[model samples]
Target: MFVGHYAAAFALKGREKEASLGWLFIATQFVDILFFPFVVWGLETMEFVPGYTETNDFKMEFPFTHSLIGSILWAIAFGGIFFLLFGRKKTSGKSIAFVLGLGVLSHWVADLFVHTPDLPLLHGEPKFGFGLWHNKAATFALEALVLLLGLWYYLKRTVAKNKFGKFVSIGFVLFLLLVNYLNYYVLPANHDIIGLTISALVSYFLFAGLAFWVDTKRT
Candidate 1:
């Protein structure tokens, strides 16, 4: 559910051209961004277990951040903050806020596809997932297909502002694919939760920054 989450961002930005792609990127991963820090703070937790799933080795116990209710609450909070910060100034404020909230909720929905029934309906209620991660090839193909389709829609909705925009946009897509590949096959599993948390936070912010740059380079 890594780069697959960004498909929501791309589709969101394409639908609402006024929404910030950077923020949308953050929104799509907002719960995950919270999940890692929650892990470090002992509010939530996960562990590296070999063969936990076909795609990765992490066994998560993130009720506060990955729960269905928690996700909805976070989305509402995110939308509220956006409304107070910048959405209030625009005529399309409500629409933008809604889209941002949708982006936040999209993370949980995407995770539902690949996760191993770890996502809770509430703090202590039942958990559910489709367990797509159990199949490596299917996971990879599904992520790539969703990302490509979203990117295609985005490109159709917006045009490049210059040569740099055109080239960099393509490069960014390749970079995302490369990262996904590395995550699945190249990167070694780190058992240290703190280190994993730091890495996850860094990667999320870096991708958000890149998405911001890409947005600026386009119309």
Candidate 2:
């Protein structure tokens, strides 16, 4: 689901211009952000079996972070915290909170399209996914299409504040596409769970920071 998740971030920013795009980026990947640490803590699990899926080799057992109910709870928690922090100061606070919560929940919905029945309804079993990851080309195309559409919507809704805003926004979108390409075609399948978790966390925060900078350059 990787960069495909950021489609939700862009869409959320488009719909709620007042909401921070950077925060939306974090919200959209909130569960996955938690999933990696959970894996390291023995609260969840993942094993790299070569050829587990056409795209990568991750066989995950992440009920607490990937379950439908768990996502809902996480969404509520995120939205609740936002409301608590800003509800009194801004008229659109509730709206921003809802958008952030939706961003959090959107991760599961997006993953449902590509994951191979790893997402759970509760703690175990009855897992579900459309398994789009079975085909590499389809996975790549779908992610690119979704991300481009999101970027288009975002650009449509927000006007650039300066030259840097216009060019950086475009460059960032291209950068995301490049990262996606490398994820599918260039990067070797990582076998070390610990190393993978560290890299995943670093990438998540790095992208969020970049999104924040881009948003600042805009409006």
Question: What RMSD, rounded to one decimal, does every model reach?
Answer: 1.1, 1.0
Over the stretch 1-219, how does candidate 1's per-residue lDDT look in tens digits?
Answer: 899899999999999999889999999999989988888888887877899888888788987888999999999999999999999989988888999999999999999999998999886658899999999889988898889888888888888999888778668877998999998889887888888888889999999999999999988
Give the lDDT of residue 84 in candidate 2: 96
Winning candidate number (TM-score): 2
Name the lDDT of candidate 2: 0.91
For residues 75-186, could you state the per-residue lDDT of candidate 2 as single tens digits? 9999999899876488899999999999999999999999999899987789999999999899999998999899999999998998878889779988988998998999
Best by lDDT: 2
Error of 1 at 63 (Å): 1.6
